[model samples]
Target: MTQSTIAAPGRAGSRGRSLIGLAAFVILVDVASATASSVTLPQIDGWYAGLEKPWFNPPDWLFGPVWTVLYGMMAVAGWLVWRDRGLAGARGPLLLFGLQLGLNILWSLIFFGMQQPGLAFAEISALWIAVAATMVAFWRVRPLAGWLFVPYLLWVSYAAVLNASVWLLNA
Candidate 1:
Protein backbone atom coordinates (compact mmCIF):
# COMPACT_ATOMS: atom_id res chain seq x y z
CA MET A 1 0.00 0.00 0.00
CA THR A 2 1.01 3.58 -0.64
CA GLN A 3 2.26 5.71 2.23
CA SER A 4 -0.83 7.93 1.98
CA THR A 5 -3.27 5.03 2.34
CA ILE A 6 -1.23 3.46 5.18
CA ALA A 7 -1.38 6.76 7.05
CA ALA A 8 -5.19 6.95 6.86
CA PRO A 9 -5.93 4.51 9.71
CA GLY A 10 -3.44 6.23 11.97
CA ARG A 11 -5.08 9.54 11.25
CA ALA A 12 -8.48 8.10 11.97
CA GLY A 13 -7.24 6.53 15.20
CA SER A 14 -5.80 9.82 16.30
CA ARG A 15 -9.10 11.52 15.55
CA GLY A 16 -10.93 8.86 17.56
CA ARG A 17 -8.67 9.36 20.56
CA SER A 18 -9.20 13.11 20.40
CA LEU A 19 -12.95 12.57 20.24
CA ILE A 20 -12.78 10.40 23.33
CA GLY A 21 -10.90 13.13 25.11
CA LEU A 22 -13.57 15.62 24.14
CA ALA A 23 -16.23 13.25 25.38
CA ALA A 24 -14.44 12.91 28.68
CA PHE A 25 -14.32 16.67 29.03
CA VAL A 26 -18.01 16.96 28.32
CA ILE A 27 -18.80 14.22 30.82
CA LEU A 28 -16.76 15.89 33.51
CA VAL A 29 -18.57 19.15 32.91
CA ASP A 30 -21.88 17.37 33.12
CA VAL A 31 -20.94 15.64 36.36
CA ALA A 32 -19.76 18.86 37.92
CA SER A 33 -22.90 20.67 36.85
CA ALA A 34 -25.05 17.93 38.25
CA THR A 35 -23.22 18.04 41.52
CA ALA A 36 -23.32 21.81 41.80
CA SER A 37 -26.97 22.01 40.85
CA SER A 38 -28.19 19.01 42.80
CA VAL A 39 -31.22 19.12 45.02
CA THR A 40 -31.95 16.37 47.52
CA LEU A 41 -34.92 14.03 47.29
CA PRO A 42 -37.01 15.79 49.89
CA GLN A 43 -36.24 19.12 48.37
CA ILE A 44 -37.14 17.91 44.90
CA ASP A 45 -40.32 16.28 46.09
CA GLY A 46 -41.42 19.34 47.98
CA TRP A 47 -40.74 21.74 45.14
CA TYR A 48 -42.21 19.45 42.52
CA ALA A 49 -45.44 18.89 44.41
CA GLY A 50 -45.88 22.60 45.03
CA LEU A 51 -45.78 23.28 41.34
CA GLU A 52 -48.90 22.87 39.20
CA LYS A 53 -47.68 20.22 36.84
CA PRO A 54 -49.64 19.28 33.75
CA TRP A 55 -51.39 15.95 33.65
CA PHE A 56 -49.43 15.07 30.55
CA ASN A 57 -46.12 15.44 32.32
CA PRO A 58 -44.11 12.33 32.96
CA PRO A 59 -43.81 10.97 36.45
CA ASP A 60 -40.79 11.91 38.57
CA TRP A 61 -39.42 8.42 38.17
CA LEU A 62 -38.89 8.95 34.44
CA PHE A 63 -36.55 11.92 34.58
CA GLY A 64 -33.48 10.14 35.94
CA PRO A 65 -33.18 7.47 33.27
CA VAL A 66 -34.27 9.77 30.48
CA TRP A 67 -31.77 12.42 31.34
CA THR A 68 -29.05 9.82 31.75
CA VAL A 69 -29.58 8.51 28.24
CA LEU A 70 -29.89 11.99 26.77
CA TYR A 71 -26.70 13.09 28.44
CA GLY A 72 -24.85 10.11 27.05
CA MET A 73 -26.16 10.79 23.58
CA MET A 74 -25.24 14.46 23.92
CA ALA A 75 -21.67 13.57 24.72
CA VAL A 76 -21.49 11.14 21.83
CA ALA A 77 -22.86 13.69 19.38
CA GLY A 78 -20.35 16.30 20.44
CA TRP A 79 -17.57 13.75 20.20
CA LEU A 80 -18.61 12.81 16.67
CA VAL A 81 -18.44 16.40 15.51
CA TRP A 82 -15.13 16.94 17.22
CA ARG A 83 -13.77 13.80 15.59
CA ASP A 84 -14.83 14.81 12.11
CA ARG A 85 -14.09 18.52 12.38
CA GLY A 86 -11.70 19.00 15.32
CA LEU A 87 -11.95 21.90 17.77
CA ALA A 88 -11.31 24.69 15.24
CA GLY A 89 -13.55 23.20 12.60
CA ALA A 90 -16.41 22.70 15.05
CA ARG A 91 -16.07 25.84 17.12
CA GLY A 92 -19.53 27.15 16.34
CA PRO A 93 -21.24 23.94 17.29
CA LEU A 94 -19.06 23.48 20.36
CA LEU A 95 -19.92 26.95 21.61
CA LEU A 96 -23.60 26.34 21.17
CA PHE A 97 -23.29 22.95 22.81
CA GLY A 98 -21.64 24.43 25.87
CA LEU A 99 -24.20 27.22 26.05
CA GLN A 100 -27.12 24.83 25.96
CA LEU A 101 -25.55 22.51 28.49
CA GLY A 102 -25.05 25.44 30.84
CA LEU A 103 -28.66 26.38 30.46
CA ASN A 104 -29.65 22.78 31.03
CA ILE A 105 -27.99 22.73 34.45
CA LEU A 106 -29.36 26.17 35.25
CA TRP A 107 -32.87 24.92 34.63
CA SER A 108 -32.47 22.30 37.33
CA LEU A 109 -31.16 24.89 39.73
CA ILE A 110 -34.00 27.29 39.02
CA PHE A 111 -36.72 24.72 39.22
CA PHE A 112 -35.44 22.60 42.08
CA GLY A 113 -32.87 24.59 44.07
CA MET A 114 -34.57 27.98 43.75
CA GLN A 115 -38.07 26.52 43.54
CA GLN A 116 -38.87 28.65 40.50
CA PRO A 117 -40.25 26.78 37.54
CA GLY A 118 -41.25 30.08 35.98
CA LEU A 119 -37.68 31.22 35.69
CA ALA A 120 -36.68 27.75 34.66
CA PHE A 121 -39.12 28.01 31.81
CA ALA A 122 -37.45 31.17 30.59
CA GLU A 123 -33.99 29.66 30.92
CA ILE A 124 -35.07 26.53 29.05
CA SER A 125 -36.31 28.67 26.19
CA ALA A 126 -32.77 29.88 25.67
CA LEU A 127 -31.57 26.31 26.01
CA TRP A 128 -33.88 25.24 23.24
CA ILE A 129 -32.66 28.00 20.99
CA ALA A 130 -29.05 27.07 21.69
CA VAL A 131 -29.75 23.43 21.00
CA ALA A 132 -31.29 24.31 17.66
CA ALA A 133 -28.31 26.42 16.73
CA THR A 134 -25.95 23.67 17.80
CA MET A 135 -27.81 21.15 15.69
CA VAL A 136 -27.55 23.38 12.67
CA ALA A 137 -23.84 23.91 13.18
CA PHE A 138 -23.28 20.19 13.72
CA TRP A 139 -25.18 19.43 10.56
CA ARG A 140 -22.72 21.45 8.55
CA VAL A 141 -19.88 19.26 9.80
CA ARG A 142 -21.40 15.90 10.74
CA PRO A 143 -24.98 15.15 9.92
CA LEU A 144 -25.03 12.13 12.22
CA ALA A 145 -23.88 14.26 15.07
CA GLY A 146 -26.80 16.60 14.52
CA TRP A 147 -29.19 13.69 14.20
CA LEU A 148 -27.98 12.22 17.48
CA PHE A 149 -29.21 15.31 19.27
CA VAL A 150 -32.75 15.04 17.95
CA PRO A 151 -34.03 12.96 20.85
CA TYR A 152 -32.49 15.36 23.35
CA LEU A 153 -34.10 18.31 21.58
CA LEU A 154 -37.47 16.60 21.52
CA TRP A 155 -37.37 15.72 25.20
CA VAL A 156 -36.28 19.23 26.14
CA SER A 157 -39.07 20.70 24.01
CA TYR A 158 -41.57 18.55 25.85
CA ALA A 159 -40.08 19.57 29.15
CA ALA A 160 -40.26 23.22 28.13
CA VAL A 161 -43.96 22.92 27.44
CA LEU A 162 -44.40 21.22 30.77
CA ASN A 163 -42.46 23.94 32.54
CA ALA A 164 -44.60 26.64 30.94
CA SER A 165 -47.75 24.84 31.92
CA VAL A 166 -46.63 24.46 35.52
CA TRP A 167 -45.64 28.08 35.77
CA LEU A 168 -48.92 29.23 34.30
CA LEU A 169 -51.04 26.95 36.42
CA ASN A 170 -49.27 27.95 39.61
CA ALA A 171 -49.38 31.63 38.72
Candidate 2:
Protein backbone atom coordinates (compact mmCIF):
# COMPACT_ATOMS: atom_id res chain seq x y z
CA MET A 1 0.00 0.00 0.00
CA THR A 2 1.14 3.55 -0.80
CA GLN A 3 1.24 6.04 2.06
CA SER A 4 0.65 9.78 1.78
CA THR A 5 2.45 12.29 3.95
CA ILE A 6 0.62 15.34 5.27
CA ALA A 7 2.13 18.57 6.52
CA ALA A 8 1.71 19.16 10.23
CA PRO A 9 -0.24 22.23 11.40
CA GLY A 10 2.80 23.46 13.31
CA ARG A 11 4.91 23.20 10.21
CA ALA A 12 2.32 25.12 8.20
CA GLY A 13 2.28 27.88 10.81
CA SER A 14 6.03 28.08 10.72
CA ARG A 15 5.95 28.36 6.96
CA GLY A 16 3.49 31.24 7.20
CA ARG A 17 5.75 33.03 9.67
CA SER A 18 8.69 32.62 7.35
CA LEU A 19 6.73 34.10 4.49
CA ILE A 20 5.99 37.14 6.66
CA GLY A 21 9.64 37.40 7.43
CA LEU A 22 10.50 37.42 3.77
CA ALA A 23 8.07 40.25 3.16
CA ALA A 24 9.68 42.18 5.97
CA PHE A 25 13.04 41.69 4.36
CA VAL A 26 11.78 43.34 1.21
CA ILE A 27 10.68 46.33 3.28
CA LEU A 28 14.04 46.45 4.97
CA VAL A 29 15.82 46.52 1.65
CA ASP A 30 13.72 49.43 0.54
CA VAL A 31 14.44 51.28 3.76
CA ALA A 32 18.11 50.49 3.55
CA SER A 33 18.42 51.84 -0.01
CA ALA A 34 16.84 55.12 0.96
CA THR A 35 18.91 55.38 4.10
CA ALA A 36 22.07 54.89 2.08
CA SER A 37 21.17 57.82 -0.18
CA SER A 38 20.12 60.09 2.69
CA VAL A 39 23.31 59.40 4.63
CA THR A 40 25.09 61.71 2.20
CA LEU A 41 22.59 64.54 2.64
CA PRO A 42 24.85 67.24 3.96
CA GLN A 43 26.91 66.95 0.82
CA ILE A 44 23.78 67.15 -1.33
CA ASP A 45 22.50 70.23 0.50
CA GLY A 46 25.76 72.04 0.08
CA TRP A 47 25.89 71.34 -3.64
CA TYR A 48 22.22 72.20 -4.07
CA ALA A 49 22.75 75.66 -2.62
CA GLY A 50 25.00 76.59 -5.52
CA LEU A 51 22.54 75.53 -8.19
CA GLU A 52 20.19 77.97 -9.91
CA LYS A 53 16.91 76.12 -9.55
CA PRO A 54 13.87 76.68 -11.67
CA TRP A 55 10.97 78.39 -9.94
CA PHE A 56 8.96 75.23 -10.35
CA ASN A 57 11.42 73.08 -8.48
CA PRO A 58 9.89 71.34 -5.53
CA PRO A 59 10.73 72.65 -2.12
CA ASP A 60 13.42 70.66 -0.29
CA TRP A 61 11.05 69.67 2.53
CA LEU A 62 8.78 67.75 0.16
CA PHE A 63 11.42 65.28 -1.01
CA GLY A 64 12.10 63.27 2.16
CA PRO A 65 8.47 62.52 3.10
CA VAL A 66 7.42 61.82 -0.47
CA TRP A 67 10.26 59.41 -1.05
CA THR A 68 9.59 57.72 2.29
CA VAL A 69 6.03 56.90 1.28
CA LEU A 70 7.00 55.90 -2.25
CA TYR A 71 9.73 53.58 -1.01
CA GLY A 72 7.27 51.91 1.36
CA MET A 73 4.87 51.30 -1.48
CA MET A 74 7.68 49.97 -3.64
CA ALA A 75 8.55 47.49 -0.90
CA VAL A 76 4.93 46.34 -0.65
CA ALA A 77 4.76 45.81 -4.40
CA GLY A 78 7.91 43.69 -4.35
CA TRP A 79 6.54 41.68 -1.43
CA LEU A 80 3.30 41.07 -3.28
CA VAL A 81 5.13 39.76 -6.34
CA TRP A 82 7.36 37.58 -4.20
CA ARG A 83 4.37 36.17 -2.36
CA ASP A 84 2.42 35.44 -5.50
CA ARG A 85 5.28 33.82 -7.29
CA GLY A 86 7.89 31.69 -5.70
CA LEU A 87 11.46 32.95 -5.81
CA ALA A 88 12.02 31.44 -9.23
CA GLY A 89 9.13 33.34 -10.76
CA ALA A 90 10.19 36.53 -9.02
CA ARG A 91 13.80 36.39 -10.16
CA GLY A 92 13.49 38.47 -13.32
CA PRO A 93 11.37 41.21 -11.83
CA LEU A 94 13.51 41.35 -8.74
CA LEU A 95 16.60 41.75 -10.86
CA LEU A 96 15.10 44.64 -12.75
CA PHE A 97 13.89 46.16 -9.48
CA GLY A 98 17.41 45.98 -8.13
CA LEU A 99 18.87 47.55 -11.25
CA GLN A 100 16.54 50.50 -10.99
CA LEU A 101 17.34 50.88 -7.31
CA GLY A 102 21.03 50.94 -8.09
CA LEU A 103 20.47 53.53 -10.79
CA ASN A 104 18.50 55.57 -8.29
CA ILE A 105 21.45 55.53 -5.92
CA LEU A 106 23.84 56.50 -8.67
CA TRP A 107 21.74 59.54 -9.52
CA SER A 108 22.03 60.89 -5.99
CA LEU A 109 25.76 60.37 -5.94
CA ILE A 110 26.35 62.00 -9.32
CA PHE A 111 23.95 64.88 -8.88
CA PHE A 112 24.47 65.72 -5.25
CA GLY A 113 27.48 64.00 -3.77
CA MET A 114 29.80 64.61 -6.68
CA GLN A 115 28.25 68.00 -7.48
CA GLN A 116 28.06 67.25 -11.16
CA PRO A 117 24.65 68.39 -12.32
CA GLY A 118 25.24 67.65 -16.02
CA LEU A 119 26.42 64.15 -15.35
CA ALA A 120 23.60 63.72 -12.90
CA PHE A 121 21.12 64.68 -15.60
CA ALA A 122 22.60 62.06 -17.87
CA GLU A 123 22.49 59.50 -15.09
CA ILE A 124 18.86 60.24 -14.30
CA SER A 125 17.96 59.69 -17.95
CA ALA A 126 19.49 56.26 -17.69
CA LEU A 127 17.61 55.72 -14.46
CA TRP A 128 14.36 56.42 -16.29
CA ILE A 129 15.21 53.74 -18.83
CA ALA A 130 16.01 51.24 -16.10
CA VAL A 131 12.79 52.07 -14.30
CA ALA A 132 10.77 51.57 -17.48
CA ALA A 133 12.38 48.22 -18.13
CA THR A 134 11.76 47.17 -14.55
CA MET A 135 8.12 48.21 -14.81
CA VAL A 136 7.65 46.24 -18.00
CA ALA A 137 9.20 43.13 -16.49
CA PHE A 138 7.13 43.42 -13.35
CA TRP A 139 3.95 43.90 -15.39
CA ARG A 140 4.54 40.71 -17.30
CA VAL A 141 4.35 38.74 -14.06
CA ARG A 142 2.04 40.94 -11.95
CA PRO A 143 -0.08 43.72 -13.36
CA LEU A 144 -0.70 45.34 -10.02
CA ALA A 145 2.97 45.27 -9.22
CA GLY A 146 3.61 47.08 -12.50
CA TRP A 147 0.95 49.63 -11.68
CA LEU A 148 2.56 50.31 -8.35
CA PHE A 149 5.57 51.75 -10.11
CA VAL A 150 3.63 54.40 -12.02
CA PRO A 151 3.98 57.11 -9.44
CA TYR A 152 7.67 56.42 -9.13
CA LEU A 153 8.08 56.69 -12.87
CA LEU A 154 6.15 59.93 -13.02
CA TRP A 155 8.18 61.44 -10.23
CA VAL A 156 11.39 60.43 -11.90
CA SER A 157 10.25 61.88 -15.17
CA TYR A 158 9.79 65.17 -13.41
CA ALA A 159 13.12 64.73 -11.76
CA ALA A 160 14.78 64.18 -15.12
CA VAL A 161 13.45 67.45 -16.43
CA LEU A 162 14.48 69.13 -13.22
CA ASN A 163 17.94 67.68 -13.50
CA ALA A 164 18.29 68.88 -17.05
CA SER A 165 17.09 72.32 -16.08
CA VAL A 166 19.57 72.52 -13.25
CA TRP A 167 22.37 71.48 -15.50
CA LEU A 168 21.41 74.06 -18.09
CA LEU A 169 20.87 76.97 -15.70
CA ASN A 170 24.00 76.20 -13.73
CA ALA A 171 26.08 75.89 -16.88
* Index of the highest-TM-score prediction: 1
The numbered model that scores best in lDDT is 1
Model 2 poorest 10 in a row by lDDT = 1-10
| Per-residue lDDT of candidate 2, residues 44-143 (tens digit) | 4676876789998988888878787778767766766665564555788878878888788888877777788899888898989988888888788779
- 1-171, model 1: which lDDT tens digit per residue? 444323332234455566566668577557845763476355656767766677898888887778778888788788777666656666778888888887787777777778787888988899899888888888787898889889988998998999899889998
Global lDDT scores for all candidate models: 0.76, 0.74
Candidate 2 Cα lDDT to native:
0.74
Give per-residue lDDT, candidate 2, residue 66: 75
Task: Assess every candidate by TM-score.
Answer: 0.84, 0.82
